[model samples]
Target: MPVQRPFNFSAGPATLPEPVLQQVAAEMLDWGGSGMSVMEMSHRGKEFISIYEQAEADLRELLAVPANFRILFMQGGGLGENAIVPLNLSRGGKVDVAVTGSWSRKSAAEARRYADVQVVAEGSGRNIPGSANTWSLRSDAAYVHVCTNETIDGVEFHELPRIDNGVPLVIDCSSHLLSRPIDWSRVGLAFGGAQKNIGPAGLTLVFVRDDLLGHALDICPSAFNYKTVADNQSMFNTPPTFAIYVAGLVFQWVKQFTYAGLQGLAAMEQRNIDKAALLYTTLDASSLYENRVEADCRSRMNVPFYLKDDALNERFLAEAKAAGLLQLKGHKSVGGMRASIYNAMPLEGVQALVNFLKEFEARHG
Candidate 1:
């Protein structure tokens, strides 16, 4: 029998699927009788090359990405891409940004160093702006950027904005990459740090439409240029070998997942929906705790809730840890408690959290 582990609710570097972890452990010593661990294989050798190709292929199929889009696995976490994105897509001209929360705000700030950034619309920090109709888009802007899911603030875009103008849409989907299906028709470029929903840190995934390539500014680093990386098939420099391999395993696990008769990504989406509903419903009904984000725009992946009494914060965390629920503290920027239920989190884990919430309130209230 497997030893029971605590249900982890960390925002990133979070819990992975148990089976994936087991598989990693079983293969850690020697991968497929090659007499070498995957970590020890040469990236240029056939062993690692096959792993990279299958990972790329499985990810494309899982997301249903179009043929016109090129999926490039590269380095630089989401923050690094904040600068790399502008360097490649900004063309040293004008760019438009919609500041919904912390992550998008950072993206806008970074782009300003490379191009003239226009704040198209701004959210109130608690909720998304009403609509795209109010945006002040620039006709000459290179691309319009948005963070689809704000991990810190617990806000998500259920429906993507429709840009009638010619500007392409660039999204930072770091926190909720594979929880559901993406409408590729509406996206021009989508990038995410693999730590949240995909895999571990140090690997960033970029899916760029073909037309957007080859536009890196003269100041763009040769290695960071999108076209060059894509042309070489993401091997311009040695890729993050271990992270990519683990992510490939995750993709395979997602493909085989099943829930409530649904399969694969559809099943994953339904499970996330169910988990969020259970937690939010409990919070809304309780007088001791509440989620501050607007109901309509609340993030399904990251749920931030606060106790009615501020004095209970420390006691609440201590009790939660003692109960085997870990990492429930919210970001310092927004104080409260956050429960991040990504694809890897099981439904039983959420149920356990809900039970603890009620039990904690009963003892304190």
Candidate 2:
């Protein structure tokens, strides 16, 4: 039997599939007979270009990205995109944001620097505030932004919200990208960092509709300009080659993944649903632990829960670590525990975590 390795539940810079890690290891010194690793290759070299093309193609196919949307492999994480999105799409006009959690709140703050920022909807940081009619959406706004999944707050929008005004809808899906299929009809653009679910930090993915490309503000840098980056096939400046390579492998893995007769994105989404259900079920049953996010909005990717006794937090983390479950500690902003079950984390990993949770509660409850 293959020996078990530790299960990691970090929110970002999270776990990667063992097979993808192995493949990356095997290609460390030489990738497909190329003398240099992906990290060493020139960004403009044919070899790296081939890697870039394949990665982009695989991602487009896997996500079912529409023909009219341009896919960009970018640097800077979700945080940087907070500024980049406003610089490109805001057009120095009104920008409306739905502040559902920490990430979206940050997005609104960053955007205020470039546009007339308005908070259309505000959640309690735990629950999305209200229905669409309650959102004070402005018809003249350049775009409306939402973070479909908030990693820190453990809130998610199971169904993408509708923007009635035909204004573009931008989603910061850094935590849940590729875990499910996207509805292109409603989205004007989508962006995500490749860490939580895709592969690594430094790589960001942007999908922008054809019409949204050329409106970047005057201050937007050439490299950060979506139109410039898209025009150059994401090579306007040197892309994050290594991250893209690993993400490509992840995309391939997701495409071939199978579950309950579903394949690819469908398979991934179903598995994520099962994993989240398992952990949430365990938490709900335990008198010693509880998740605060509402049931309908709970994130399948990141789950933050609290132990009944805060004094036991340290012991819980240490015990979980010793049990081969890692990074169960929640974000510092929220004093509790979190389990980031990304695409790479198998059901077995979550089960191990569930078992550990039960044992810990039994001992300390």
Candidate 3:
């Protein structure tokens, strides 16, 4: 029998597939007969180049990204892209942002440093705009920004808002990048950090439309210039080779993932849907726990809940840790427990968590 690992619920720098971790461990010292660890290889070397190219191609295929979008592997996490985005795409013009939750609020604040940022649509701490038409987008705005999934607030946008104006849409999909299919028709740019669902930290993926490149402001660093990074295929500076390698393994793992007669990304999406539904159903039926986000806006990946009796918070987290469910602590800003069930978190893991939830609630309720 296979050994069971503790289920990690961290929001970022989160869990990866066990197979991917195994492959990384197996190849840590030497990769593919190159006699060199992936970490030791030069970014420009063919060994690493092949890894980079395959990672990009596999991600493109997995996400069904259009040919017009350029996938860039760069340093700095999602927050870096918050500034880098406005520098490249804002052009000092108006940027209309839909501030739905913590992450989008941060995105709006960051963009304000580089452009005239507007809160086009505002959400209560517990809810988000129901549709694209609800936003107050500007006709002349350079781009409209949204964070598809807010890890902190436990909210998500099932469908991206569409802008009939000429302006494009830029999204911070850091938390739920590969959990489901992205409707690319409504997105001009999408960015995410590898740590959440892809790979280790320090690698950020930026998918930008071809037309949006080459428009960086004069002050933008050459390394961060979207056109420059694209021109060099994400090697403007030394790319995160090890993270890319691990992410490529993840992509391969995702491709081979099978579930209920589904395959690849399709299977991953279905599994996620089922996992979220199971978890939410359990929470809904309980009197001891509550998830505050609106049913329609709740994130499938990040589920934040509270104990009816706040005094039980520490006891709950302690018992949860002893039960092998790690990182169940909530963000300090939001004092509650959060479980981030990202792509790599198997259904069995969620089931284990669900089992623990019922047991805990029964003992406490």
Give the alpha carbon lDDT tens digit for every residue of 176-255 in model 2: 99988899898999999999999989899999999999999998989999999988999888888899999989988898
Q: Candidate 1: which stretches are off by over 4 Å?
A: none
User: Mind giving the per-residue lDDT tens digits that candidate 1 earns over 219-311?
Assistant: 898889999999999999989999999999999999999999999999999999999999999999999999988998999999999999999
Pick by lDDT: which candidate is best? 1
Candidates 1 and 3, the one with greater lDDT: 1
> What lDDT does the true structure give each of the candidates?
0.93, 0.93, 0.92
TM-score of each candidate structure, all chains considered together: 0.99, 0.98, 0.98
Name the weakest run of 10 consecutive residues (lDDT summed) in model 1: 125-134
Model 1 steric clash pairs = none
Query: Could you tell me which residue pairs clash in candidate 2?
Result: none
Candidate 3 residue-wise lDDT at 95: 95
